[model samples]
Target chain A: MLIAKVIGTTISTIKDPTLTGRKLLILRQADIDGVPFGKPYVAVDTLDAGVGDLVLTAHGSSGRQTEITKNRPVDAVIMAVIDHLEISNRVTYRKE
Target chain B: MLIAKVIGTTISTIKDPTLTGRKLLILRQADIDGVPFGKPYVAVDTLDAGVGDLVLTAHGSSGRQTEITKNRPVDAVIMAVIDHLEISNRVTYRKE
Candidate 1:
């Protein structure tokens, strides 16, 4: 799983049939502080995460474990919305 | 799938029991000309690919679709060894 931030949304009309009606979002991996960096990637949004929301994404086959993403060709999925992050006993980030 | 270059090997004494006897290799994504870039990642090597070899890796559940990686907790697999890469009408890279 990766700590990531929902950066934006994707609207695809011609895609795998299994993906019809699915919500795909753009995300970037965030550090422990919830600051996103690196190249952007797309993931299925099972948790209704919106832009600017910090979330946890499960990649690979694990992405398909969700009810909404099962049997789909997509490789990444937003599985959890982060409420806060703690590291070494200190709170690094909290949802606004 | 990603075009990648196998950079090195991994020797692990303790890991998932299912990964016992599996060969893991480090790799970096490569460009159309087979020049590698980006952070390194580890993947199960079923094809005996060596360091500096250009290969194609399957990610997510697709990584587990291979007989050697099936049901394992691994997220990446070197499934194909690239013979060459062609874009448009030109051969960008060929195995040496």
Candidate 2:
């Protein structure tokens, strides 16, 4: 799973039929501190997460494990919304 | 699919049971010209690709579509060895 920050959303008209009405969001990998970086990629959003929310994304086939994304051509899916992050027992990030 | 260059190999004894005896190679993403950049990642090599070879990798569940990687825990797989790359009617790279 990648710790990522939801940066924005995507609107696609002509896409795989399996992806119709799916919510695809733009994301960038984030560090444990919840700071975002790197090139952005799109992932199917199943959890009603909004922009600026730090979330956990499952990639590959695991993205299809969810009922909403099953058998879809999508490669990434937002599986969890991060409430906070801790490293070595020290809180590094907390949802605002 | 990503254009990547195999840089090295990995030797792991303790890993997911599904990955036992798999050939996991290290790779870095490459441009159409075959120049490598960014961080290195591991992928199951199903096509006997070797170091210095520019190959195409299928990521996510697509990596599991192959017979060698089916149901495995890996997220990436080398699916094709690139012989050459062309862009805009020009060959950008050719195997030596």
Candidate 3:
């Protein structure tokens, strides 16, 4: 699952207690017609998407399917926030 | 596992009653050619990657590498910081 667009954020008060209080953003990968690909990585958010919102990004193990990242030191998470996005049928986004 | 970028970020006063403090960033998909395709999306960061930093993100179960994210609710996570990236017969980005 990939359709991103939240372009900035990085904060760390010394990490690695299994990544205590996770929150780091920086993604730029969009496909399925919207365009804007390549270069830009960093994911660790569980919904509550903002900053140009067009969400619904879950990769690998389904980004853990959240129960607050299910098991532990999380990966990518944003379950769902996209209301409408069509490719061949058009209607790229419609979540007003 | 796509080649990703960092164009921006977002945050809130969270702390995780599960993930009350997970920071979110937007992302767009990129090909190995270093071309920007699609629109934009998001990812949860694992490293202190910068706006221009190319990272190695883990998908599915791979995102659950770290002890923090091991066997948890994570889906995608940055496994390596990408010291240098090469695609075909060339060097994409190297460690400075």
Candidate 4:
């Protein structure tokens, strides 16, 4: 899993039928210091994460393991909302 | 899905039991022109792609959708081997 911040939501009127009713959020990958990096991409939200919320994102088929995404064509999914993150025993980010 | 090239293999003696007997290939993301880009990462192979083979890779939970990867903890999987790739009506790569 990778750390990311939900940036916004995406709505498409015409898309795969399986994607209907799924919450698609824009995610910006974040480094340990909570700084955003890499290109922003769309991710299916499974944990009710909101914009500005730090999330743990699973990529590839693991994104489909969630009940809501099973058998869907999604490639990325938000699996958990991060409360805090630590590296090398040092706290790096704390969700507020 | 994204295009990538298998670069090598990975062996782990200690890993999730579900991952046993699964072939793990290292993949380098490639652009439409077949030029490698971005950081290399590991991906489970479902299509028997070999090192240097151009492949289509699915990320997130979609990687686990394959029969061999179902219920596994993997995040990336190679789903198809490319015979050729075209962009703007021009062939960019053709398997030799």
Give the TM-score comparing model 3 with the true structure, all chains together. Answer: 0.48
Candidate 3 residues lying further than 4 Å off, grouped into runs, are: A1-96, B12-16
lDDT of 1 by residue, A1-96 (tens): 999987655433333445568876667789999998975556789977888899999877788888997765556788999999998999999999
Assign candidate 4 its CAPRI class: incorrect
TM-score of chain A of each: 0.97, 0.97, 0.33, 0.96
> What lDDT tens digits, residue by residue, belong to model 3 across residues B42-66?
5557666655556666666776676
Q: What is the TM-score of chain A in candidate 1?
A: 0.97
Stretches of candidate 1 exceeding 4 Å from the true structure: B1-60, B63-96
Question: lDDT of each structure?
Answer: 0.77, 0.77, 0.57, 0.75
Q: Report lDDT (Cα) of residue B84, candidate 2.
A: 63
Clashes of 1: 4
> DockQ, per-model, please?
0.08, 0.08, 0.12, 0.11
> What's the TM-score of every candidate structure?
0.54, 0.54, 0.48, 0.54
Model 4 CA deviation exceeding 4 Å by range: B1-96
lDDT of 2 by residue, A4-79 (tens): 9987554433334445688776678999999998755567799999888999998877887999977655567899
User: Given candidate 2, what's the lDDT at residue A89?
Assistant: 98
Q: Give the per-residue lDDT digits (tens) of candidate 4, residues B2-84.
A: 89987655443433445668877656789887777765556789888887789998876677788997786567788999999
Docking class of 1: incorrect
